[model samples]
Target: MHKRVTFDNKLLPYLLVSPQILVTLVFFFIPAGEAVVYSVFSQDAFGIEINFVGLDNFLFLLNDPHYLRSFGITVFYSVAVAVSALIPALILAVLADGVAKGATVYKTLLIWPYAVAPAVAGVLWVFMFNPAVGIVAQWLRAAGIDWNYKLDGDQAMALVIFAAAWKQISYNFLFFLAGLQAIPKSLIEAAAIDGAGPMRRFFTIILPLLSPTTFFLAVVNMVYAFFDTFGVIHAVTLGGPAGATNILVYKVFNDGFIGLDLGSSSAQSVILLLIVVVLTVVQFRYVERKVQY
Candidate 1:
């Protein structure tokens, strides 16, 4: 009985973890498997006929001009948002780190936006950009800038990109702040004693130390920009004027749910998943080569 009791105590942790393991296998793996299975198949009008058509959907998407356009737009959006968000976030993080007073207040104000839902953020931005009554629209017109998203594809893309980037600043800032806080003050002091200017110290010392955090945020923000901003695109642009805002995930939503072309949508989703996986791999590989600590 003593031995049995000891064995049960040792096995309890595994038992506790089993539920999560079971749930993941059932919910995540099963659906992913189904998606892969369906991607190779074709569905007819009745929606009941799922015939295995082996790469037909993939080939069709490859040849489709609209898919090509959306793919380009998606990549552009992700890169633009990543670059725009990273710079400002780094600046804010540094500023927060240097503040001698009210740092908490500044940090709180900066981080507040992260709490807002992307759909809500999109709605707020759209209201601010409203041509008739939006404060931003009024300011733009007064400044002699033509900024109507309804008529201009460039303006539409910019609006969506800005909105997406704006919400992301808070998330990036949080990571950056943590990274900045983690850096040893002794290193900064050493750099200062060695006659390193603030900019030089940042570029050479601080940036290198922060590379791991930056890399993490890069991958995370890229994934969010690609997959999670569906709410923003849906609420704000709905893939907008002449399919200009039709990004990959939005395209997936449009095709899979709205257009009810499940097989093609699954194919598109599979492609998007592959792109994300590839990007994640590249980031890890690049970081492994350069990250010192």
Candidate 2:
């Protein structure tokens, strides 16, 4: 019985993690391997050709204007959303930590938008931006503001980026709140004793201590803006108005599913995967070096 119990204890960790491992293999690793295999070969709707084209797809992507534009647009969108979301999340977290009155109420109100599905949020934003029926649009019209997302490219991009950033604010806040809470009050008290001002204590002690959490949230927010905002774009913009809001993921969807150009789309996906993996690895490495614990 002792030996059996020992065997079960040894196997317990693996048993607990097996479902996650299997899901990763099935959904991520396997599909990524197959995508690499499929990227080297061109196939039509009927799936006839099996010829090895080597790096032809990649070379073609390098020369393709639309692919280049899509890559640039994706970078711009990712940066825009990250900066916009990070600033507000950081400020809100600090305020929530300091405030004595109705902190829970403020947190609950701030996090409410996170409960709304991305697709639903996109639809709601679109409804609000509608020219005729939207309350926002009506207010804009009454104020003599000419806000049109359909024809104008810059305005359209701004609207999409704002919506995407709005969706992520709550997630960022949650991570930041956890980080703030994890910080020991003793440290702050010591800083106060040493004549450190609020701003000084925050920049010198709190910031470095919060490095791990900030790194975590940054990677998460970047990846979310990169891969998961497709539903919002689909519901709101559909990459419309002269392809202004078409980021890489949406471009991949349009190419692979809508246009049936799987080879090019797979190549694009591989590039995206490489970018994300490199960034994530760098983040982990940087955090491991900086984190106190």
Candidate 3:
């Protein structure tokens, strides 16, 4: 039987949790409610006028070529970011886990990037890959490659994807390392005693144990790529080289803040919110089933 904490006073428990409830109300529900409200109405370029157009904004978005393109790009971008971040992180975590000495140092160095803001990380990468003065850019050019993300749309997408993925690596690495460390050493030893080599032991034992961590990271990384990389894309590509990097979130920003299309932006936000919710629910309902305890 599980032990349950007994509260001295029911009122005391409510008082302690009230603050968190208030914060959620203020920050999440309020904004989400406002987005839903705004999405149904049309406002002139000037914010003075408002008219309820009912599903018109959403309908407009559904028919918009640019919005469709952005949605497609976002799908591709999220997948790329999640895969790129997770694979490299898992590799690094495996390598670091095997280090008998200086393990802490390696882990610390790998995790340092997680502390940096997405925007700051993007700027750092842009400078390092700037076609004119960036060292890597110069090296690439010297190797007879015409490398310039500023003018090449595909290159710009690749750059933003790389920057987003790189920033997320530290976060993924921390979780992957923790998961790797938590696997019981006895299980591995038993497998080894049965003539299992490193690769065989890892594939048969370690990988199955890691499924839970991988699934969790998949959900988190999807969300990160969908929303949190806004700063990185803003600073690095600004959805450009011809709007080629205009993922849905960035498009929402552009339409709402820059283009001053409040209704459309709000509608997009609602759609994105729904997409995330559905994806998370699907993951929990289906993907979680495959995760090993």
Q: Pull out the clashing pairs in model 3.
A: none
Candidate 2, residues 1-293: lDDT per residue as tens digits?
45453454878899999999999999999999988887887788567766678888889988989778877888888889888888899889998988899999999998988988877888888999877787887898899988888887787788888888898898899888889999999999999999999999999988888888787777778888899888888888898778888998998888899999888888888888888889878877875777665
Question: What RMSD does each model have against the real structure?
Answer: 3.9, 3.5, 1.6
Q: After superposing candidate 3, which stretches have Cα over 4 Å from the reference?
A: 1-4
Model 3 lDDT, full chain set: 0.93
lDDT tens digits by residue: candidate 1, 26-85:
987888787788899989646777798999989999999999999889989999888888
Which residue segments of model 2 deviate by more than 4 Å? Answer: 1-12, 46-52, 285-293
Sort order, lDDT high to low: 3, 1, 2
- Reference-based lDDT, residue 71, model 1: 85
Q: Report the lDDT of model 2 for residue 78.
A: 88
- Report lDDT per candidate: 0.88, 0.86, 0.93
Give the clashing pairs for model 1.
Answer: none
Error of 3 at 76 (Å): 0.7
Worst 10 residues of 1 by lDDT: 1-10
Q: Which structure is stronger by lDDT: 1 or 2?
A: 1
